[model samples]
Target: MEKESGSMKSSSQTRTEGSKEFEFTARDFERVRALIYKKAGIALAESKQEMVYSRLARRLRATGISSFVTYLDRLEQGSGETEEWEAFTNALTTNLTSFFRESHHFPILAEHLKKVKEPIEIWCSAASTGEEPYSIAMTACEAFNTLTPPVRIIATDIDTNVLNTGANGVYSIDRLDKMSPERARRFFLRGKGAREGQVRVRPELRQMISFKQVNLLADNWGVSGPFDVIFCRNVMIYFDKPTQGKILDRFAPLMKPDGLLFAGHSENFLYVCDEFKLRGKTVYELDPDRKTSSAKLRRA
Candidate 1:
């Protein structure tokens, strides 16, 4: 018993303090590759085997692990490996988000939200760093002030790191440069001198949005929503056709009638037949709302 305890303690110590020249065995690559794909739909090519190791190298070093295999073992054994997985996902997942990233959609949103003249509920399906949701809030501030209820934004992201940033509601000035000066002045409060040049979205606007974790591919979303608008922008491009189609199919029931769906500029109903009308790239009004048969989108 004493010998077993001693050996375990030594193992834990070494695992906590990792070594240099971390070697990721083929088995490690296989395990992580499938894990990423299964969870996030990120398909890693054979060439990317070293890319994972290279990216994880910094993480291993930060945790004092010098060898890839050692850090890999640490990941398997550590109680906090969930956070490590988040770090890995953040490193690997493409985060191409910015405020008002695809400007075209905002005017449509403004017009639609204003037209509804009802309690507004919007979803930023891949809210990322909260910029997209904040942009939505700002647009609402300018567009729907006279409405009976202010806009309600639900900002969700699978990436916990970005969601945490989103919850913080603070961002660099550069992130806000694309925002209109008047809107920026109205919605953003400048960070103090020590944190100079940084800006934080006003609490009123930030409070209007709820940030939560949601894996779109999961069996159950655990979200209570049939959102009036779903801005699932830029997140679907990583998926293959079957995956994209299935996602849209599943997402339809989660939307309200007359609600709009916004995909990224690069995504569309090209092969995603049946459920949507080809209103335009990045825009699809829910088919059920189409008063005319002509509004129905065709299979390509």
Candidate 2:
């Protein structure tokens, strides 16, 4: 009884540090930011400190805590506040991705799939709310000229709520406004009544992809993959150097030797000299046989 009480007291002290005004300091933001980067490969700026705090503030309030200091303390102390951690990570992480968000990338995907010889597997690492992955699937259907069993997509996200929504493959009308008219008509089913003007991705596209909850930081990945392509766009900016390296190292084995990797326009391989070889400006080719090098690259 005494030992358990002491442990509880120590936990309380740790949490108290976070709950105090001192807990939400610049240093605390940096600590949380670094942890997020390490865990999710999310790159965030100090300017986002307020965003993190404010978003988390609402969550803390929802949890019946009024002060960030107390909230920070609860977060740090693990005072049975696992929901707080999930809320923190979910709110801080960006999910700005959309269906065919970067329309330009689809042609690249089509071109790559045209060359794949084996069972084609694609991983949409930042597949948010299912749009992107669904787009990939529909693109595959277009690429192959038919829906075949061989084409598959694995879409993963850190947020369960979004994962559920993605798996549902539903979206509002406004979000669908950007989709090309032909694609929109073919791909979306118009909802009515309470969901009037909203849309859901057609079952054909939704069926081709599998959705799962994944945190990039957790160990082992519990996945066996040798993908033909990995769409890891817009995900690496949140991570620092070492975290980026570790993720790439893990990413390499999941990709085939000649597999293609696509990243967001904002990300680059300029600083990452190892793990993956540059295939093009926004794409990489995993070359495990080649040692990591600072090799000059020009498109063939």
Q: Give each prediction's root-mean-square deviation over alpha carbons.
A: 10.0, 10.2
Candidate 1 global Cα RMSD: 10.0
The Cα local distance difference test for each model comes to: 0.76, 0.75
Stretches of candidate 1 exceeding 4 Å from the true structure: 1-20, 24-30, 45-51, 63-81, 146-149, 289-300
Off by over 4 Å in 2: 1-31, 34-43, 79-81, 288-300
Worst 10 residues of 1 by lDDT: 291-300
* Model 2, CA-based lDDT: 0.75
Top-lDDT candidate index: 1
Can you write out model 1's per-residue Cα lDDT over 196-224, one digit (the tens) per residue? 98999888887788898887787776665
Model 2 TM-score on a 0 to 1 scale? 0.82
